[model samples]
Target: MKYQGSCHCGQVAYEVDGQLDGAMACNCSICQRKGSLMWFVPRDQLTLLTPESQMATYTFNKHVIQHHFCPTCGIHPFGEGSDPKGNRMAAVNVRCLEGIDLEAVPVKHFDGRAL
Candidate 1:
């Protein structure tokens, strides 16, 4: 399914083609703090609808994930990272997606904090 999302201040926007049934709640420090439920999709499945300058990238720890956010509102609508096999992917924040039923999607718990 196709979905549209944006940062809280509307400075950053994107369109993604994916499903919500597989959304996840990761226990990583950043994930826990942000409280964003994520869904992974191929990089090609997501398109940024906003100007590149409107978004800022942040990376920490191993510096693998490129965490993108709106500098204006500090809202992280999505992030980009590679899987173990080196395939690029997008980790979309399901909460940012439009018209999604939060209750209908099953949230998987990932022990990212333990990694």
Candidate 2:
């Protein structure tokens, strides 16, 4: 399935093709702080609908994930990284997706902090 997402201020937008069935909540420092439920997909499955200049990238710790957020609204709609197998991947913030019923989705908790 395809979904549309954007930052709170609408400065950053994107489209992602994937199923949200495996949405996850990571316990890592950043994910824990943001409280975002993410859906993982291949990098090629995500398309930025807005200009890159409108977003800011953040990295820390292992710095494997490029957390992209809207500087204006400070909303992290999505992030990019490579999987353990070195395959390009993207983490889509399910909260940012349009018409998403977050209450209905079961979130799988990932113990990223332990890694």
Candidate 3:
């Protein structure tokens, strides 16, 4: 499935092809505060509509994961890595998705902060 998402300020927009069922909700500190649901994909599957310079990245603790957000709006749109093989992925904020019912999408929970 192809999904389109953008930042709250509409500065950053992107289209990605993947199944929503592939999404996961993590119980880590940042994820808990942001309440982000992730849709992980291979590096080849992700396409950024905006320029790389348009996004801002933040990482703390282990720093294996690259958390990308819109610098203009301060919304963490997606994330990548932390797993082996260096697979590029999108840990999108399900709340950022438009029109779909987030609660209807079944999700597996991960204890990210713990592991």
Top lDDT model: 2
Model 2 stretches astray by more than 4 angstroms: none
For each candidate in turn, give its C-alpha RMSD to the true structure in angstroms. 0.8, 0.8, 1.7
List TM-score per model, in order.
0.96, 0.96, 0.86
What 10-residue stretch in candidate 1 is worst by lDDT? 17-26
Decoy 2 TM-score against native:
0.96
List the lowest-lDDT window of 10 residues for candidate 3.
82-91
Per-residue lDDT over 1-115 for candidate 1, one digit per residue giving the tens place of the 0 to 100 score: 8999999989999999876667999989899999999999989999999898999999999999999999999999999999889999999999998898888889899999899
How far does residue 59 in candidate 3 sit from its true spot (Å)?
A: 0.9
Candidate 1 lDDT (Cα, 0 to 1): 0.93
Candidate 1 wrongly placed segments (more than 4 Å):
none
